[model samples]
Target: MNILILGSEEDIHAAHLKKSLTEKGITVDYLDTRLFPTKLKITWQAITHTGCLIFPDGRKWDLADINKIFWRTFGGVNVPKLTDSYQERIAVNDSMGLLRSFMRSQPEKWVNSWEAYEFHKEKPLQLSLANKIGVTIPATIITNNADEILEFSQAFKDVIFKPVYGGSHTQFLTKEHLEINRMKLALSISPVTIQEFIPGTNIRSYVIGEKVYSAEIRSSSLDFREDKRAKLIYLETPEDMKKQCLAITKAFGLKWTGIDWRFKPNGDFFFLEANFSPMFLHFERETGCPITEELIQLLTS
Candidate 1:
């Protein structure tokens, strides 16, 4: 079977997956979004719904032959030092537009389709569904209003904040951050997601189809990722928790997802966020979960 990995060529996760798939005697190719317009070409016939992907070295692959597309990354050269800014935007957008058109026209074989990407972007909706499912979730608010931010911070004494759309590291809302002027200036640029900070073990559950593999991430830092020495240890998910994880994944319409949680001291887990394209090489290596194997199976099947 020929599988397409939709990700950057430099993405370690994609590279690892390519290696694994190739070892299994599967033909694997990377569809790095960044390589378009400059190093590659795309063409499609409207009437026939036929198309082929042209690579840099004159190699072309008929789009129909692709068995499955492993949805990993979406977007064109995220960091291109093009000579012209305006032109760069046009180039990237144009390339992405056509690529998306092709993606939209293709048959349904995406591991987690473009729709999953849309669902992931709406954190508010995801959290709401989690809460409705009876899953524990921290009280949270998303807004750019400085007054509301300060009010929420004051109400929940200990609170943490991050980007509403997910990018920056989570930071505690400190006493000094209560200043309206500072918050107004910073938040005016973009909306911020502030949540009541829950102290507990950092847990991540990888839901692949009907299986849920979990791990306890140990770190001294507020954001486990900030700690270079952070460790991921395998953990058995409680039957109840497993059901919740599966529900969350299905609710999100995700074929594979990484659900972050906070296991509070009271033996309860507070739902954090669900990652549609979470990196898993580290989790697999440390926890010995068959993450790659399952993903490969999903794509090849």
Candidate 2:
């Protein structure tokens, strides 16, 4: 079986997966999206009515021929020294757009298409989906109006603010004591998402095909990255929690994803969000789970 592990050169999990699949006698190839040249051609095949991806190097990697495609990253490269944003945007957009169409052509096998992977980038949409799946979610509000912010703050007393779009520019999930100050509204020009603080323990559920594992993450600070002094610990999750993790992944049409579930102080599981392509090696070392082997089995099956 031929497998393609789509990711960036900096992605550690993708590297590990490639090693595991190779050990299992699968022909695994790594395609770093950043290495894709600025030029690519997409042609519609009249016979199949599907788009074909042609690399600038003249190598043809057909989507239909791939036994499995583990999408490790999507739309994450910055063309260095580009003066024009339009040019850079076009290059990245075209690559991902073509890649998305290619993946959509496949009807079977384990694959994480760009469309399925993109669901995690939107926090509000994820929360809505979680609610529909009978998973507990915190109360949230998105608005730019000053009056609305004040009202929600007064009602909820304690709230956490995060960006609607996921990016590294801002921080996430900082536990703040209720101190309603209306002037903070002027900090941004866009609508801000404020949610009721769901106090709980942090748990991450890693799902690859039918193999699912859950681990509790313990961090002293609300924003784990903020305080370097803070430490992280991983603990195995109960069997019932593993079932919930699997259900969440299937609902997202995802064969591989890392789910973040917070156990609130009230002894309940609240769905935070899913990481479409999460790092597995480090987690496996901490939790002692054989995620790499499972990925290989799915591709080879």
User: Which candidate achieves the best TM-score against the true structure?
Assistant: 1
Runs of candidate 1 exceeding 4 Å displacement = 75-93
Q: Which residue pairs of candidate 2 clash?
A: 200-263
Which lDDT tens digits does candidate 1 get at residues 55-82? 7788888889888888888765543668
Off by over 4 Å in 2: 35-44, 49-59, 76-97, 107-110, 168-188, 227-236
- In Å, residue 262's CA in model 2 sits off its true spot by 1.4
* TM-score per model over all chains: 0.91, 0.80
Worst 10 residues of 2 by lDDT: 169-178
Q: Once model 1 is optimally superposed onto the true structure by TM-score, how far is the C-alpha of residue 25 displaced, in angstroms? A: 0.7
> What overall lDDT goes with each candidate model?
0.87, 0.68
Q: The CA-based lDDT of model 1 is what?
A: 0.87
Q: Following a full C-alpha superposition, what root-mean-square deviation does model 1 have from the true structure?
A: 2.4
Query: What's the residue-level lDDT of 182 in candidate 1?
Result: 85
lDDT of 2 by residue, 97-174 (tens): 655555566736446766676666777887888788777788877766656766777676557777677553223423
Count of backbone collisions in candidate 2: 1
Q: What local lDDT score does residue 109 receive in model 2, on the 0 to 100 scale?
A: 45
